[model samples]
Every structure is written in structure tokens, then in C-alpha cells.
Target chain A: MSETDLKLPLDAWHRAQGARMVSFARYEMPIQYEGIIAEHRWTRESAGLFDVSHMGQLVIAGRDAEWGLEALLPADLAILKDGRLRYSLLLREDAGIIDDLMVTRRGDHFYMVVNGATKHGDIDHMRTTLPSGVVLDHMTQQALLALQGPKAVDVMARVAPGAEELTFMTGGGFDIGGVRAWISRSGYTGEDGFEISVEARNVGDVAALLVAQPEVKPIGLGARDSLRLEAGLPLYGHDLDETTTPVEADLTFALSKRRRESGGFPGVQRILTELDKGPIRKRVGLFVEGRQPVREGALVVDAEGSEVGKVTSGGFSPTLERPIAMAYVPAAAAVPGTEILVEQRGKIFKAEVAQMPFVPHRYHRKGASA
Target chain B: MSVYFTKDHEWVRVDGDTGTVGITDYAQGQLGDIVFVEVPEAGRQVDKGGDSAVVESVKAASDIYAPVGGEVIEGNAALADEPSLVNTDPEGEGWFFKMRIADPSELDGLMDADAYRAFLADQ
Candidate 1:
């Protein structure tokens, strides 16, 4: 680890488990334990534990907090029900993405989680924009862990009996092993899982308890990236940046109906215009023809070999047993079955635009079968 | 026949004027979960230390350099279907390609097994 690289609360434990550590978001994080592919498969088949403590957790409280937050984000936070989580994007003045985040209403206050790499900037941006009455508290003493997979609910039920009651995108405070924790039935992987927030000091006990289950193993960042990629969820720095808008990034679903109608948020004109007319370039999924993985930054080309766009995320999907990628392309070429080419390392391969979540999501929504 | 290693962790086994090449075990270990391998086509001439092949893991891709100048003879066809063979049996069935050695003197500068182990230790 470098001198400036911070370590997670479970850093020592990860090293003890023989995790390959890498620098991510200024933190020395475990990239893989057994291996990326194996861990990814395990997460899909069984439960895999992830240490996501680097993500920034914040609490926004005080009167008019929701309205204050509404000005900077596209989501209608005022209508968000208590104990429900909604994925939202922090937008800049020009409607470009500042960062994508999760905001959960906790009755009187809002609990928000932002990407690790952009948390500090996000905090600064919020602090500067929000009214003086609203308070922003960065929850530095909390550690977040994700227990994700098909068996995740079973494992969570085994430890915290009533945790299974919380459906997808729902969270509430619960007690596990006598430790106070806030858990949400949500995850980046397209699986039924829970993200638990615990006190930093007691996080190790919670992690130990979860991994002790026969169905659970410690997964690392490598599998996390591949899992999200396979699920068609975009990484912030790679798929989303300050240069891209939510409409262009295929995240217009996060724009609430009320927000779309009233249009009070920053860059509302541009966003509403793009939403109505459609973006010039849109994010789309590419299914490569062969075994070769077309990685990020590879050029998307037309039949004439003219560059149209660039790949943002690409990898071999263990589930699909082929190479898959997500990239931005001209609106005309964004339709499924549109043939395109990916150029990488001086080699060109045929690719086709496909609908995403390349794998179906298994979220345990309310009233849905387990 | 003798096996020689390069500082970049590739190995070449010389049998007469033909040298069979593949990445070292350490190289495969460093690159977890080999997903794809791109090899130079047969009849292509390569220079010493030039990019000879490409190995891709789920996370990143790396170039496999030619330890010495040679003309490609054949690439392992099995890798196109199962690249993990490079991780499972890196030295035996996983050999990447066979090349016709350009100059016999190039082998003299390569490392023996003992020297290669020492080089790894130094790293």
C-alpha cells in the first residue's frame, strides 16, 4: 500500500484471507480473493460478501432538507416514502452528471450514499448548494458491507431473522448479534441481497458472522466490477462522468414523473429537452461475436471504419459465456440488433447492440415470489 | 532441448532451430483468470522484445513479448476455446506458439531456470 492510500476497517482481515490488494479511490482494496471469475460465479450461485466501506454515507437533516436536496438532484425527494431507497443522480448546472447516488428516506432525515471516488467533491457541492438550515453529516464512523447472491436472503435470515421482510430497495434499522445495523435489500449485482451499515468497531463481527454461513464467501472488487458490468449497471468514472448527462447515460428512469413535469432541478430545460426529443448519443449494450473481450476505451466503428463512440465497460460474462460490453453510440445505432464494430489493439471484431441487464435481475420486490 | 526464460516472464524451449514459447507460471498467476489469448499468425516475423501475443484477464490485458526474434510457426488453437489452459497447464499443453528461431546466438543471452528464479526473487 502507498503512504497516501487509506485502508478499510477489514483491510487486515482481507490480507489474512489472501486477497490480492489494489489501489482504488485512494484506498487499498481487495481486488480478488480466490479469483475474479470464481468469485463472480459464486456470487451468482451462492452468497458473496463484499466490504464496501469506502463508499461515503451521509445524513441530511433539518427542515426543508428534502426541498433543498431536490434543487440539485433530478429525483422528487419530497414524495419518497420513509424507509424506501431511490437511485438518483447529482446533476451539474449544465445537466451533466456529478455523481450517481442512492438516497433513502429515514422518516425525519435522508440517508445518502455516494460513490467513493467522488464523495468529497459531492459533499463540497452539497454543502455549497444547500440552505443554511439543512445539515450535512458525513457518517465516517460507519462501515458498509454487501451480502449478495441467490442465497443472500437465506443467510441474512439465518443471522437476523426478520431481515427477509425487507423487500428490494427497502431498509430499516435492525439488530444483529446485539450490534445495531441498518440494512437495505439492495445491491449492485443483479441479485437479491442486502447492504448493511454497521458501526465501524463492530463491522468485523458482522462480517465474520455472515461469512461463517456455508453459503457465503468473501468476494473482492474484481468480481464486484464484473458483476455490475454483467448486470448493465454503469461504473461512475467509466460509464458516467461530468461530461455525460443522465439521458445520454440511459438513466432517465431515475428522473421522477413529477420532476419531469414540473422541472425545477438544475439544467431542467436541457434535461427535459433531451428526455422529450431523445439524446444524440445513447448508452447501449454490445454483444461481441467471439470469445475475445472488447475492453473499455475500445473504439466503436461503423462499416466504413469511422469511429462513432467508445466503449465504457466491457468484460467476459461468466454467466453468458461470451464477451459483453456497454458503450455509447449514435441514436440510430442504439437499437437492438444494429451491427457495429469494436476496434481494440489494432484488431476489429463484429458487435451488435443488445438490450441490457444482459442477465435478468432477480430483485426480491414486494409481493414477488422468493 | 533446453528451456530459457526472459525477464518479462516468458519461456522458450529450443528443440533444434524451432523454439516453442509461452508465458511463465508466475506470469499467469499474476494475471488471474485468463479469458482470452491473441497469438501472432504463423509466418509473421517478430523482433526481440517486440509484442508477440496478448493475454487478457477479466480485469486487464497484457502484451506477451517475444524473448528473441523469430518467425511464427503455429499458435495453439485450443486456446481459442479454452484460454484458462494457460493458467492450468502453462508449460505443457498451454504453450502459446512455435517459432523458427531467427538467430541461435539470441538464446545465449536468455536466463536458465535458476537465474530466472533469482530474477523473480529480486523483483
Candidate 2:
């Protein structure tokens, strides 16, 4: 729409492939290609390439970059080693979450990836909180591509052999078709995949090279939402917000053990109290009984038809072949297999608090049973 | 036999007292990858244009309207588990349901194949 609205490096290529595109987070993005279910299953079984260049990438460089970031976020960034990625949560003064982001340590600089929709606010918060010496450089010239699914490793090996040695949640620089790029073995799809940060100029060519592989198909936001939902990952504006705390969102594990003990991060008082006293409500997984799906903002009721909680996210889980959802319910009712009711329209449907993910996550981690 | 269509994208074929009902191919294309079909129960009375069934896809849900006044006699039960059939063969195995005609004159208000094609172009 506007000149400032970001476009992915493969925008034209996506349109040429008959992708149905829409404006999401100020970027023209493909909602689906071929079909949502087909692309979804392809990502699970083979590979799917996604244009995530819309997400904001910034580099915070300074003499005390880790400590500078720790002053704003609720995680102990000092423990984060170079090349390793750590999930961190930005918090407001009231202990509520501002945004959840990935922080990567690169020498004296911390590479940060924040949600596309909240990038501007997150940058402002970082600039205002961190000292003047810390420079927040937004990498708007870079295009991020996510090559996800089981076959991603082999696809990456063909272009950048150095990518194979990089373990999960680690990133490094390498040559991708002679174009230098930052590649990470991390993704949001709950599958083994890689996220490549390439220069905007060469993004289209590199994406074409990757998608040309027989196993690599182009996916869109429709499947991306279902995949993340099945994986039990939180969507920023929906499942998390400024009023929800990291502990209440079930993301307390993102805080390192040393940070938990030291309690020096933002909103540490309320967060540590919630961690010890337990949150009043907790986010839980819901397995619907029938084919009828429940959606967001639906009322969650107890057995007596009394409203107790609300569904934050719900949909038909393609991987599970049944409908599943996530809701924030009373901690007493958040146990696995606890029965809850979801009301859509005027009818009430039966649902259970099932163990997440609705489908098992296949993250590439060391000592994994897979 | 004369084939007619409703503005809601439902097609009906009429011959004497019997008429067949199905969604148009254009409607199926718009509702990508139909995953669930809620067919009207047999023995239910229907109107010339009313909600008769529902088709759910990964993206959205659509209501199927009856093209002619009739009482449902049989439904395509195969679609309950395999709704994608609607995408593959919307006019054949994907037919929603068959009904006994309650009023044959209701077909006169519906559009024929040529008019329906013209109507789609305007859309």
C-alpha cells in the first residue's frame, strides 16, 4: 500500500506462482499457494519455503550489549554464548509481556529478531531503555527466508555446507550460491528447518535456487498458522499481549536458571513472584471432541455452563486430523485430560485439556529420540 | 431435462417430479479444499432458496442453498469423511443431496446454464 510497507525478496515470484497474497503486518504476503492443506502436509513430510522477510531484524552493538539488552528484556542475556539463539521476552513495568523475541549473540553485538507487527514499538522501547552507547541498527535491507520441514537439512547442505554443522538454535555466516548470508537452524514450524538471512538483492535468486529442489515447495501464511498452532507456539498479538505475563503465557522456561536465581531483569519482582506462587491462570491445550472447530475469542465454560476461561487460539489440527485449541484457564483446571466446554454461536461443544503439542514437535535437538 | 442455477451457486437439474442438486464448479474453486460437509437430513422440507447444507474448508465455511423447493430424500454420505471430493468432482460424486420436488414451478425462477455463466462473468 505505502512505500514503507515492506516487500519480500520473492514477492514477484510468489505472485507468478498464482499465490493468493494479502496485506499482513504491513507486508504483501502469500496466504496460500496450491492449497493450505497440501502445502501444510508438504512442509511436514518434505520441505516448504516461506518468505519471513517481513519480520524485523536488528543488531544491538555496544561495549555492554548483553547487559544493555538484559536491562530491557526479562532474560539473562549474559549467559547467551556467541552463535547461540535464546528466546527472550520484552516486558512492561507491570510485568506484562511487550513482545517475545529471539536474541542471538554475535561477538559484541546482539542480533535481535522481533515480530513484524510490533517491530517499531519494540525498537522504540529498546532505544529508550538501553544506554546511548548501544546502537540499534535495523537490518531492513535483509530478506529472511525460512526453509522448513524434514528435508531442509539436505537442501541447505547443497548451497551452504557449513550450515549442516550448526546445531539447532545456532547461526553462522556462509556462501549461499556465492551470496554471503546469515543462516540459522531455527524455525517456527516445529519441524527441522533453517532460517536464512540474505541480502535483499540476492533473496529472490537464493529462494529460487532452494525452491527448485524437488522437495521444496512454496508455503504461505495459512499453513504457517496451522503449523505453529499444532506445534503449541504462541502468536504474539493473540496468545500473548502487553497484559499477559511471561509466566502466565507458559513461557517462563525461556528465562535461564542463572537469571531465575539472580532476578536482575525487568519486572523481575512480579515475574519471580509469579514463578514461585504460580500464576492465577495458565495456558492449556484443548482437544475438541468433534469435527466442528472452535475459534479465537470463544467462551470456555465449566461443566455447569459457567464461564471460567477463554480460548485464545483454536482450529482444525491438520496433523492430528481433529480440532484442537489453546485456552487460558484456571490453574486448577489446566491439568492434562481435564474437560472444558467451548461455546461457539449458541451451541456448546465438549473439549479436553490435552497435553501439547496437539501434535508432537520434531525440533532438531541433540539427544532427541527422533 | 433442464438444468438451472441459483444466485448462491447451487445447480439443480429437473425432470418431471425429480430434481438433483449440487454446487457449481465456480463455488468449489472459491472454497478451496473442502474438508467437511454438513448435509441436510433426508425427509426434511426445503424452500426454493434456503440453507440446505454447509461445506467447510480449511479457509472458510459456505452455506449451500436449495435451488428448488423440495423434500430431501437422499444425501451423499461419502462426503462426511472425504469432503475434497467436492473439489475434484463438484457436479458428479460431489452432489450434495437429492430431493423429491415439492413444487416444480419453483424452477422457473432459477437461471439456466447460459444465464449462470453470464452471471459469473459479471461477478
Candidate 3:
């Protein structure tokens, strides 16, 4: 928010496009381009391009990069094939989440994208713990863009003719709009989409190429948040934090079978024990019953009005036309049909514990139709 | 018969001792797509410049302070279903509530249309 805020690669471009810039992770980013609700609906029905260059992209390589990473993360990196991406989490010694990230193996090196706010801390943690044989390079000069939605594949096809061939969670290098980029069929919006990584200097061409397509419009962080919230994806700072564990966050799926059995990672024992016995508190989705939106810092109160849990991420879901939220409640109150009492600013609301992915995911799978 | 505005962007349309209050069009435009509004109910008493109503956009929630002290006469129930009216017709149908003006002298401390326009420009 200050004048000292670092500029994104597309800072001038965003300003030229009438985007409202806000400070995030020390970088000034576009919070909205046109309008949040309009851009949100547009992305749901069509295609939207997002400038996510703020997220840290790191390349890990050398002798034992795979083994070095597996020792720190919970995912089964041993089985991850080349040109594929797997969602994984870095854990603390107590099984608490350090950060949720994506790890992709591209030929000889593994590329990891971590949350922007925690990238420096994540890199520091890895550098101290990883074996000396492994090398981690922070690719600060690379800019990332995500083309997401129902028509994203079509838009991506037009940008890079062969990129659409890669299915969900897969990636490869491609020349997009004459600029070389590592394009992947992966995104945060729970839709058929692609994440493109290109040189910061060359990203303008790639962005122009994607947005030039009729289906694609430039989206912003504001819509990006609402889209992911509707997708039931937890944001790192808001939903997944240092005090929350993967099991408690209902992210046990990210803990691969091999890692669960071999127990080599940080806090492997604690995580496995919780997985078996069930965590005391569980992250649950809420279907807020009213039109008035309940926001973060709202308390989950019991009948007696005592605080039992807290809302982490809560907002109005543009697609659902109602308010929804995510909270960590007692395991007993985390059931699908349980009534959740949420209190905000002296007003109480009735919310129901609902299954996540509030909007049905439309990822383009191998055999299933998108 | 005339309107006075508060620095906070609320406008009070005064007619004798009764006043109708709501946020300004400029305020609504800045808020961008208000999804929810909590209007003051009848019989409620509010002080000038006190936080009174709640207006929430998709991105954030903002408080609409009372432009001047008053006793609430009627809440704008129409806003419950069509909150976007605040965006489309903020100075008209989007009026939040009708109130009995506590003191006509309170209007003397507020800005007229010309002064409010100058205030916005200064901002």
C-alpha cells in the first residue's frame, strides 16, 4: 500500500487496463481489472487470464533433488512422472503446514511454485534442511500467468497450438505468441485451464496472445480469490497457515501412500497419527444461510455464545449467489449437515456444514468430459 | 426540500423535520456492486456521524455512518432483494431509511451540494 511497494512485471500494463492496484506480498498487484463480480461471472462462463507473477517459481536440481524434496514434503514425489504436476505441502516439525505448493518434474529439474508471501521463508527452510547435493534456484525473472475457465483450453490452443494436448496437471515447454514459456494444464480455479511460466521481459507478448482470443479477458486478484473460494481451494495465508496441519485442513489426500508408510518427512509420525485417530479440529465448508456475508475473524459460537472455532476465509460467492465460508471447527461439528452458528459484529448467522467444491469442478480429465 | 452531505459520503435529503438518508452515488460507485445492505429499523435512534448502516461489497464491508442524528421511521426493505439499486439509483430508490430529524441545526454543520462536489474533487 505504500510508495515503496515493488511493482509487478505488468504494473504499467495493469494500470493501462484500468485495474485497481493493491499491495500484496510486498508487490503491487491488480486486485480487479474491470469489476470483481463481472470478471468472476465472465471467467465461469468463458476464459480469464490472470497475472500471477508474484508467486515464487523455484527450480531444484542436481544429484538428489527428488529425494531432497520428498524428505521435506508429504507428497509421494518418487512416483511423480516427468512433465506432471502434483499438489504438495511443506510441513513443520510438528506436522503443521509451512505452505501449500505445486511441484512439477520437468526433465532433469523439479520446478516448485510457492505462495508469494512465504516464498523467502520457504526457500530459507529448504536451503537449511535439504541435502548439500541438491540446488535450489529462485527464478525471480520468470513471470506466471494462468488462463482459467470453461473455455480456457480453447484459448490456450489458440495461443500455443499443441498446449491443449496436455491434460490436467501436465506441462511442457511451448512457444506461445512467439515467446517461449513452460505451459501447463493446471490452475487454481477448479476448471479446465493452464498456467504459463515465461520470462518476465517476454510475458507481455504471452499475455496479449491469450487475451486476444475472443473467449479470454484479463482477470484480477479479486476475482481470482472468489473463483478459488467457490472452487473450495484453500488459500495459503487465509485457510492454510503455520498453525494448521494437513490432516486438520482435510488435505490428507496430498499425503501420498508411500510417504505415509515410509515416514521420512518432517512431522511424519504426528501427521500419520492424526490421520488414523482423526484430528481434533477439521476444516469444513459452510453454506452461509443468508444474503448478508459473514467475513473472516467471525467467531463460530456455540448456543451459549462461547467461541468454539474461527472463520478463516469467508465471502460472498458470486456464482452461487449466496455467502459461503470455510472454518476449522471441532471434528464433531464438521459433518456435512451440522448446523454452524456464526457470529459477526453482534449479529448471528445460521450456517450449515457443507461438502466442499461448492461449485462442481469441471476439470478436463483424460476419459471424462469437461 | 434540499440535500446535505456528510464527509463520509452519506446524503440526507431533508424536508422539514423528516429526512431520507442513503449513501451518495459517488460512494456507491467507489464501493462497486454492493451485495448486502443493513438498513436501520424503525424506532432506532442514531447520533450524527455514528456508524449506523452496513453496506457490503463482494470484496469488503463498509459502514454507512448517519449523516445527522435522527430517529428511524422506516427501513428500506426493498434493498433486501435488490441491493444493486444502490449502484443503479443511489440517490433515489436506493435510499436506506426515513428518519425524523433530531435537530434541524445539525444540517447547518453539513455541506450543501456545491460544497460536497468540491469536497469530492479535493479527495
Candidate 4:
């Protein structure tokens, strides 16, 4: 490890568990324990504990914090209810996405989680953009852990008791083994899970307690990437960037109906225009024909072999047992059944545009059928 | 028959003028799960250090380089369906291809088992 590389609170724990550590977002984090495929399968079948402390946790405080955040983000923060989380995007003035984040209305203040790679930039952007009264607090003292899978609720209930009552996208404070934690029933994987935020001092102990359960195993960044890719969730630096607008990224759902009509946020003109006429390019899922995985940066070509778009994220899905990718194709070629050719290493492979979340999302929403 | 290794972690078991090629156990361990393997067709001429095959894991794809100049005799057919065989038994059943050595002198330039083990330690 380099002198500049940061270490997580569970860095020692991960190394002790035989994790292969790699430099990610300036942190020497675990990329895998036993293996990526095994870990990915275990998370889908049961429960997996992930150390995601590298993600930035921030709190937006002060009197008009909601309205202050609304000026910068396209989402309608005022309509966001207390204890509820909304997936929102931080946008540039030109309608490009700065970063995709999760914002939860925590009664008095808004708690937000941003991607680790862009967290510093996100904090700086918010600090400069928001009014003087609105305060941005980088919660560097906290560490985030995700307990994800189908049996995640069972495991959470076993440890934290009242955490089972918190449905998908809802978060509240809880006590786990005398350590206070903010637990949310949400995760990047398309499974029913929870993301727990605790003090850096208590994270190691909390992680150890969770992994002790038979259902939960320590998962690494390798499985986390594959799981989210299979879930059709976009990684920030890869699938999303400053040049890609929310509309082009197929994340128009993040823009509330009220926000769309009111037209207050940045890039409203370009965003509303795209919303009306549709974006020139669209992000869509791909089903590769052969077993050979078409990786990111592979070109998407049209019938005449002309370059149309590029794949953003691609990987072999452990759950589906095939190669899957997400790419931005021209709007006309973005249909679910449209045929497209992917070029990689001077070879052209057949692929078809498919609907996202290749595996259906199994969020544990309240009053929903299991 | 004697086995030779390359600095890139490719191995070749030499039998007269013919040799069977596969990656070393160390390389397979680093690759984690082997999802797919694409080998060069039979009869294709391969130069020393040339790209011979493609090995893919769930996370990334890597190119397998030819350890020595040879004429491809046969690509492993079993790996088309059972790529993980490379992970299970990399040196034996996981052999990627068989080739006819173009120049036997190339084998003299390759590393022996002891030298290869020492090379791995340096890495």
C-alpha cells in the first residue's frame, strides 16, 4: 500500500479474512475474499456484508436546507418525506449529471450519500452552490456497511430487532450491540437489504457481529460491482459522468413530476426539452449472444458498421449465467428487442437491446407481496 | 517429456517437436473464476510472445500469450463449455492448445521449473 492510500476501519479485519486488497478511490479496499463469482452467488442466495465506508456520507443542515438543495439537484427535495430516501442526481448547469446520490429527509436535516470517487467534488459543489445559511457537513467520522440479500431482513432483525420494521428506502436510528447506527432498508444490489451507518470507532465491532451469523459473509468490491451490474445499476465514473444527462442516462424517474413542471433546477431547459422530444441517445441493457463478455468501452455499431454508441458497463452475470452490458445507443436503436452489434478487439459480436434490471428488483416494500 | 514456463506465466509440456500449452496455476489463481476461453484455430501460425488465446473472468478479460513460436495443431474443445477447468486443473486438462514447434531453439530460451518459480517470487 502507498502512503497516500487510505484504510477503512475494517481494513485489518478484511486482511485477516484473506481479502485481496486493491486501491479503490484512494483506499486500500478488499476486492475479493475467496472469489468474485462465489461471493456474488452467496449474496444473491443469502446475505452478504459489504464494507462501503469509502462512500461519502454528508448532512445538509440549517433552516432552508431542503429548498437550498433543490436549487442544485433536479429532484423535488421539499416533497421528500421524513425517514424516506430518494435516489437523486447532482447536476451541472448544462443538464449533465455531476453524481448520482441517495438523499434521505431526516426530519430536521437531509442526509445524503455520494459516490466515493466524486464525494469531495460533490461536497465542494454543494458548499459553493447552496446559500450561506445552508451548511454541508462531511460525515467523515462515520463508516457505512451494507447487509444485502434476500435474507438480509432476517439477519438485521436478529441483530438490531426494530430494523426489520423499516421497509425499503426508509431509515432510522437504531442500537446494535450498544453502538448507535442509522440503518436504512436500501442497497445498490437489486435485493432486499439494509445499509447501516455507524461511528468509525464502532464499525469494526458491528461488522464482526454481522458476519458471525451463518447467513452473512464478508463480500468485497468485486462481488459488489457484479451484483450492481446484474441489477442494471450504473457505476458513477463508468455508466454516468458530467457529459451524460439524466434523460440520456434513462434516469428521468429521478426528476419528480412536480419538479418537471415547475422547472426550477439547473439544466431545466435542456432536460425539459429532452423530456418532451426524447433524448437523442438512450442508455439500455444488452443481452450478448455468446458466452464471451462484451466489456465496457466496446463500440455499439449499426447495420452499416458505423459507430452509434459505446458500452458503459459490462460483465458476466453470476446469477443469470451469461454476459450482460449497458450501453448508450441512438434512441431509435434503444428498443428492448432491437438488434445491435458490439465490437471488441476487432471482432463483432451479436447483441440485443434488453430491458434493465436484467434480474427483477426484489425490494422489501411495505404492503407488497413477497 | 519436460515442461517449460514463460515469464508471462504460460507453460508448455514439450514432447519431441510437439508441445501442449496452458497457463500456470499461479495465473489461474489470480484470474479467480474463468468464464470463457477463446483459443486460436488449428493451423494458425503463432510467433513467440504473440496473442494466442483470450481468458475471461467475471471481472475482466486477459490475453494469453504464446510462450514460443509454433504452428497451432489443436485448440482445446472442452474449454468451450467448461472454462472453469482452467481453474480446477490448469496444467493438465486445462491445456489451451497443442502446437508443432517451429524452432526448437525457442525452448532453450524459456525458463525451467526452478527458474520460473524464482521469477514468480520476483514478481
Each candidate structure's TM-score, on Cα atoms with residue i matched to residue i, is 0.99, 0.92, 0.98, 0.99
Off by over 4 Å in 1: none
Q: Per-residue lDDT for A296 in model 3? A: 84
lDDT of 1 at A357: 88
Candidate 3 chain A, which ten residues in sequence have the lowest lDDT sum? A361-370
Docking class of predicted structure 4: high
Candidate 2 vs candidate 3: the TM-score winner is 3
All DockQ scores: 0.87, 0.49, 0.83, 0.92
Once fitted onto the true fold, the runs of candidate 2 whose alpha carbons sit more than 4 angstroms away are: A1-6, A367-370, B15-20, B43-50, B65-74, B99-110
Task: List the pairs of residues colliding in candidate 2.
Answer: none
Model 2 C-alpha lDDT per residue in residues A105-193, reported as the tens digit of each score: 98778888999999999999988888878899999898899999998988888888889777789999999999999888898899999
User: Candidate 1: DockQ?
Assistant: 0.87
| Ten-residue region with minimum lDDT total, candidate 4 chain A | A72-81
Candidate 1 vs 2: which has more lDDT: 1
- DockQ result, candidate 3: 0.83
Q: Give lDDT for model 4.
A: 0.94
For B21-79, candidate 2 gives per-residue lDDT tens digits of 99989998777777778888899998877889888777566778898888998888888
Candidate 3 lDDT over A280-366, as tens digits, reads 999999999979888888999999999999899888999999999999999999899999899999989999999999999888777
Candidate 3, residue A220: how far the Cα is off, in Å:
1.3
Model 2 residue A103 lDDT score: 88
